[model samples]
Target: MTPARVTGTPGRTRVLIVGGGITGLAAAHRLRERLGPDAEIIVAEQAMRLGGKIHTVDFAGRPVETGAESLLAARPEAIGLAEAVGLGDAIVYPSDAKPALSLGGELLDFPAGHMMGIPGDPADVAAIANAKERPDNGLPILEPGADMSVGALVRSRLGDEVLDRLVAPMLGGVYAGDVDRLSVRAVMPQLAAALERHARLTDAVNEIKRPPSDGPRKPVFATVDGGLERLVTATSASARAEIRLGMTVRELRQTPYGWEVIAGPVPDPIKIKADAVILAVPASPAAVLLRAVEPQAAAALSGVAYASVALAAFAFDRVDLPERSGFLTPASEGKTVKAATFASKKWPHLGRRRQIVRVSMGRLGEEALLQYDDPTLAKTALRELGEHLGMRLPDPVEQRVDRWGGALPQYTPGHDARIAAAREALGVHRNIAIAGAAVDGVGIAACIASGQRAADTIAATVVAADR
Candidate 1:
């Protein structure tokens, strides 16, 4: 383990960032830009490696993302950060090949005109799921600031078919959460806000679907040409912070001057002081660290649960595949594989090389599946993928499995309010900030935005104190 560069020296204009994942890295980079070159910044990560869930592998003839495959391009924070980090030319969009859904053991096109599988018109999804709307009670769908479960909202507005077949499969591929436990406000904010204004779900869908202008629509998703890991490395280099790898930040203390962080091993601890500190780790560690300083915030965060998931990447020499990009499977199908992304077909760069397919496995309450050995997990992914593809496949040229135990935070109903209350509790602090996947929505863009906000807050405080 590398020794921490900065010691517990107070009043150094130094900023300590906990966790070396994308969130922490982004915060550090933005801090350097705001605080100028002389300000000291450090990134401490428990793991030897960085990038958090965003991992890229050198597979076949190109680099592939085994964790988060793409960024939500519509969000500016991620794209803007990538461009700032000199990955503008490397940004690539997915091919026009649309993904399919496996329903009743058959691949079918996703319902047209829908918001995460809730169709604008019932007729559009009649072929897949029967949309049964509730009787109009002479009132709007939901009151202002009210919240409900995604399943309760969908099942009440549409039916279980739409919830189970369309929404669950599509949303599950991203969140790895059960629709019944997920929040409507947090997961579908735009639509949820629309619901407050309109009486029908169809009207809410149309409102969200309204085009910004007559201009051409931009790509919904994107990735770097080399891989997402490039974004991580480039951003860290640009930040120029003191990188502390394999170091766990165990405690945080608010002193008369600023703040003190106890990091490194349990036996031999390192106390590092800074003008301000930002926490960018997961919910569990974040809660544990905050328990001493802010109990109310920590209690709220402690209750937040997480879902474990795994991915298996395979590179085949040659094989016939469908014209589609990939397929998504609903949990109702009772299959281990929830979704499969045909990387070669989806990305134009990889299309020229081997047929690369990444299969996503596990969901809430399925953590035991990840306990299996690598070979067993890979074989299970292969078998389930074959079942989805409806064909026997030859041996893959290369295969790798990556497990993310409790990688994804499960946002339950009223999650937004709880997190807001938590933030409100900590808002009294001048030199402390919180940012992570649990702080806001999960995605490269959301995390980046959260980190930048934290950076801006810390920068403002430092400037004010100096003035």
Candidate 2:
């Protein structure tokens, strides 16, 4: 069926942003800032609520995150946005707590000076390294602009023990991806850049880890006192956009004057016309929407894979746990649980309330685990937690299982090139832009930056057309 394009009234420009996730809402906020109150901005979210993966729920009479708990505060985008949305004072950093790795039935401190499990100092990871392994003679040569799987690169330089016991666990904690397929350039760009100049991987990592010649060090991570979702709520409330929940955007087509977004249910779909559009949904949905307008872009986006994972949050009345935050299980350990974060121990604010722990499960090729019922998944997490702590845990006072399907985008080898191709194809349409974790970085800060950049690009293109 041909999509109908409705025209906006004269002198007014309408911007329609699809997805209504953090990225989409950030775009809306940026649009309001750039275009002012006069410009019409609309955000369409298919889900009943906003924030996407940044979901928080009331547990044991206190708010807790079922999805992402903290924001990478090293980047200014998230902190800047928080301040803009009147949530500056509510920001809280995690308590000083060390993380450990679960290896060979023991919890050991994660090696120091490592980036995503890639050890900067070989001696630091002696606990996990093979005693029989000899010292590295030299790092393998990587051609300029070349890319390889993070696992392949690490294994080649550091050996199987480091790749399996160190790198995979760390990378899995973030991406829920297999190190053998994850891209070093996309996931660890700084290290990849440093590798081009240095011959040894450890030297490159050390260079990347070097402290900058600047002022006092800032907190690396932070979140709202109540919940990270507060940032989403505050941003949505501050944005001047008309947010429509349960509104699915089906397709996008260019119009003579602007762009037409075909959205809503099939039986009674609505065509909304806009001077510009931002596609901020996941890669799969975005691919379908862009297939009609930009096939090449869609093809590139289609190649982007995603990983699904589940979080099981448990609250206990009285339980004994270590002083450290949590422990991560390497894939080679063959554990059902990937990582466990002791919320009560990690956050002082929560520690004052009740003992709560969050267990994460699943990885890139572990979709079958997600098929299990919520109760079963929770039990799996509980069992794994007991095994890791080496104690028979009592029944939890409260428990919640939150499954996030396709929550993380896998930045495999050639990810940057694929994104570049899609952006080039999309450049032909000045009034349209794409932004989200799929094309850019995955962290909250990166998503915020991507959304703001897309908004800026669209605003500039529209202003140029008017001039």
Candidate 2 global CA lDDT score: 0.87
Per-residue lDDT over 1-467 for candidate 2, one digit per residue giving the tens place of the 0 to 100 score: 44454445667888999988889989999988988888888999999999998888999877899989988888799999999999999988887787899988899988777778877778888877751223554654466878899978877777888888888888888999988899888998888788778777877888888575588667798888899889998998889788889999997889887788888878777888888999999999999999999999999999889999999999988898898889898887898899999998888877555789999999998999999999999998999899999999999999999999888999989899889888998898868899999989999899999999999999888778878
**Stretches of model 1 off by over 4 angstroms after superposition:** 1-11, 210-215
Taken over the whole model, the C-alpha lDDT of each candidate is 0.89, 0.87
Q: C-alpha displacement of 265 in model 1, angstroms?
A: 0.9
The candidate maximizing TM-score is: 1
User: Which portions of model 2 miss their true places by more than 4 Å?
Assistant: 1-9, 131-140, 212-217
